[model samples]
Target chain A: MKTAENAQLALLLEVAGTPKPGNVDRERDFPDLRFEHFLAGTVGAGPGLRAAEEGAPVGESFERAIAGMSQQEGGNTQFGALLLLVPLVKAASANENGDNGDAGGDAEDAPGRLSPEDVTRVVEATTTEDAADFFRAFDHADVYVDDPPEDAAELDVRRGSDAIPAVEERGVTLYDVLALGDDADDVAAEWTGGFERTFWAADRLAELAGSAPASATAAQVYLELLAREPDTLVAKQHGEKTAESVRVRAQEALEGGPEVVEAFAESLVADGVNPGTTADLTAAGLFVALTRGEVSV
Target chain B: MKTAENAQLALLLEVAGTPKPGNVDRERDFPDLRFEHFLAGTVGAGPGLRAAEEGAPVGESFERAIAGMSQQEGGNTQFGALLLLVPLVKAASANENGDNGDAGGDAEDAPGRLSPEDVTRVVEATTTEDAADFFRAFDHADVYVDDPPEDAAELDVRRGSDAIPAVEERGVTLYDVLALGDDADDVAAEWTGGFERTFWAADRLAELAGSAPASATAAQVYLELLAREPDTLVAKQHGEKTAESVRVRAQEALEGGPEVVEAFAESLVADGVNPGTTADLTAAGLFVALTRGEVSV
Candidate 1:
């Protein structure tokens, strides 16, 4: 329950953080997607999050979370975030139950309550049915994705439920499906690479916590993450070149101070260059930090 | 689950709404309370809300909710709101299970999913233990309240857990404790008076749903509510005359238009006159509306 609660709080905090640079936050809303929609999405996703905490299969829980989350007016408010969170939540629950064995060394250890290896184990255990469910979940919301490489056309996420047959026929696990896109998708890379970036960002967030407000801590972590990588959603919507430029701008904004970061945020929004994937990653990191008590209310 | 989900959504929506005069909303926060704190409070209150859905006693659920809600850094974000929500959620759960019998009429009826009469019955059936728990809950947070009448000093909420003995000795139910303050507290009035204002405001929200953004509809309903009555929190903190003047200003702002309402909201925040109780009522109203499908994600 604590893990699920913290995951939900992470969604709220990520969206509430200001100067997030081209992402929806308390102070800014895209024309079609308002802050209230995110609030509704967070509320809607609760039962599914609880499902994850109760040890439901990651794919089923993620699919359920996305279905509920898409009920809000905003389309796809937290799809990528939930993709990262559901498995993490399941892993945290496993750690609590000592299902992780020695992977999570001590239950009482604050920062190690959730182990990246455990999350990787959970994802790697996904079945073909999980991959099919992931495709079905994609149909629940309109998410942006670049065209898949020609060889992987049968497994394109954009095919939504239509590609489920191929996924089942090929016996592709959810991890396998994500691994296919790991090169271009940061979220997929996290799934295939033991959640490397998510854990790193979570550590950064832990270090910044208590020195500032949670939202400010989140914003700093967001800036750091955005500066470090080209946001996949931005890359899909624009191009890799534009996404790389946004990363450079994020780095400069971080070096230039708060006012410059605010200005960079304004420019990105004005240009319709949303680093949505970075925001999603930040939410995931927050969930990790929260579960470890590195961040608290 | 639906009842609890709607109740949680109500808390989020109430805080996310903009131009809510003198109260913390998406666009405004008191110096001591950032928007993130309310988000945290909402998340913290989830377990207690789920308890209500599972038929936990109203007092225990309310106390549990407060204990969790006060975990946030902002001291008190939704004390009055939860005071109204706990019994209402319990009533909704009972209605769902057909425990409300003929009082709630048919199950398929949309707006009749929760009955005011049922909520009143639920509150009226509270035990002395409930009153003790309510006082114990008060010790969890710093809430603003006027001193109790001289004759009822033993019942003072400011006494927190210290007043529990008097409440227990008097064999006061939670309803009785609230009834004693009904003349001064709008939230108490709702409890003892069959939740009349809450139901009325819910109907208003129902009428306004889908016409605009949910937040805008909420802001409009908030203006109407503030215009109709002096906010109890405002009256307690700033005197009856000031509270009434604020009410008059709300009425004028409603007539004067959105710009006027926004300006009035700024002025109230500037003056430190927060209509917190009115905001609580709005949240209760949103919960009722959400449960009835009058409002949706």
Candidate 2:
């Protein structure tokens, strides 16, 4: 429940976050998904995400959660967030699974010390059906992702669940779809790189959250991450230059300190720029922090 | 589930709401109860609040929910809000009890109408133990209700459950305690008068929530109500005149429209003037709206 609840709370905090620029906060909504949709989707995703604690397969949990999200009005309000969460949720619950015996060999660390290999194992375990469900989730939320390279085969997200048949015919696993996008998608990068950035951000969030309100801590962490790198979602939606500019603005705000961050938020919203990938990262970080008990659920 | 979820969601929305002046929003935390405490408290109270649908006595539901709230760090972050929500949540589920047969006599109000008389019935059903538990909840949350009237003789809230013997000796019910404060407390007034304002605000929230996000709609409703009259808690903490001035300021902001409302929010927070009772009202209104299926849960 901690894993699932933390993931849900992280998503809630991410959406409730103010002056978060372009992403849907309590004050704004995207044409594709209203704020309520995001909330509904997050809540809807709960039971599926928690199954990891009960030793459910990682792919199966992802499929259930994605199917649940699709039932909401928005096709994919938090697809990136969900993708980031699946591994974290599963990893957080990995220890509960370890109750049978020691799947964990690292006695130096605690029972569920998240290792890069575990992430790889979980990702590689995803089935073609999981791939299909991921594609089907697109029907519920039109999440921003780069167009496949011209050499890539047909895979329109708008096809809903129809594309699942093609994926199976091609024997393309969910990992294959994510591998193709890893170069341009932070979420996919998390999967491919053993969630390196998520672990790092989670550490960073742990250090920063103690001094501020959780939401404020989250916003600052988001701005810090945004300043560090251009958000991939922004780049996908509006070219790399625009994404860089958003990052530059964040960097500038950071240079001026916390007070400037609020002004930065207002201006970003005014300019219609959203550093969504960073927000997603913040959520991932929050998941990590929550799992580690650095932040309360 | 919607009843429990809506109740929990309403509490989350109330706490997450920011720039609404001096209330304990996500950005700020009261010394005794951090914002996270409220979130935890609300989530903690979920199961108990949902029992109303199972034909649980209103007092039983209230007692269970209050006990749940006490288990959280913030003993009384939402004491008034929970008090307001108890009957409202139960009333929202009132129709479910009708599954066996129809107890709903008012068809004009629709499928699940929360009537004043129903609220009264719920409050009237409380036993001295319920009164005892209510006092115990104070140990968890130090809600700001006025001191017992001079004529009421030993009705101290600080007595914890220890005062239940006195309460029983006096034969004073929970309804009697609420009735004692109805003249000066909006929540108590709702209990005594059949929740007229809650229903009215619910209607307003339904109208406004259509065009705006739920939190924004809730904020506007809070301001509208605040503008109309002084908040009882604000009046208790900072005197009636100060409360009236806060209402006047809200009214002034209303005169200038939405943009001014934002500025008014800054000033209110700056002045440390919080219309908590009205915020409580908005939360109640949201509960009614959510329960009625007028607002998304």
The top-ranked prediction according to TM-score is 1
Name the candidate that leads on DockQ.
1
Of candidate 1 chain A, the 10-residue stretch with the lowest lDDT total is A103-112
Weakest 10 consecutive residues, lDDT, candidate 1 chain B? Answer: B103-112
After superposition on all C-alphas, the RMSD of every candidate to the true structure, in Å, is 2.7, 4.4
Give each candidate's fraction of reference contacts reproduced: 0.76, 0.08
TM-score of each: 0.93, 0.81
lDDT of candidate 1 over A1-297, digit per residue (tens): 278888999999999888799998988989899888898899888888989999989888989999989877789899999999999999888888777644334544334478777788899999998898899998999988877778889998988999999998888899999988889899999999988889998999999988877888998999999999999988988999999999999999999998899899999989999898899889999999988888876
Worst 10 residues of 2 chain A by lDDT: A100-109
Clashing pairs in model 1, backbone N/Cα/C closer than 3 A:
none
Q: Give the alpha carbon lDDT tens digit for every residue of A116-230 in model 2.
A: 5555667777778778777866665566666775655476555657777778888878888888888888888888888877777777878876686666677777777888888
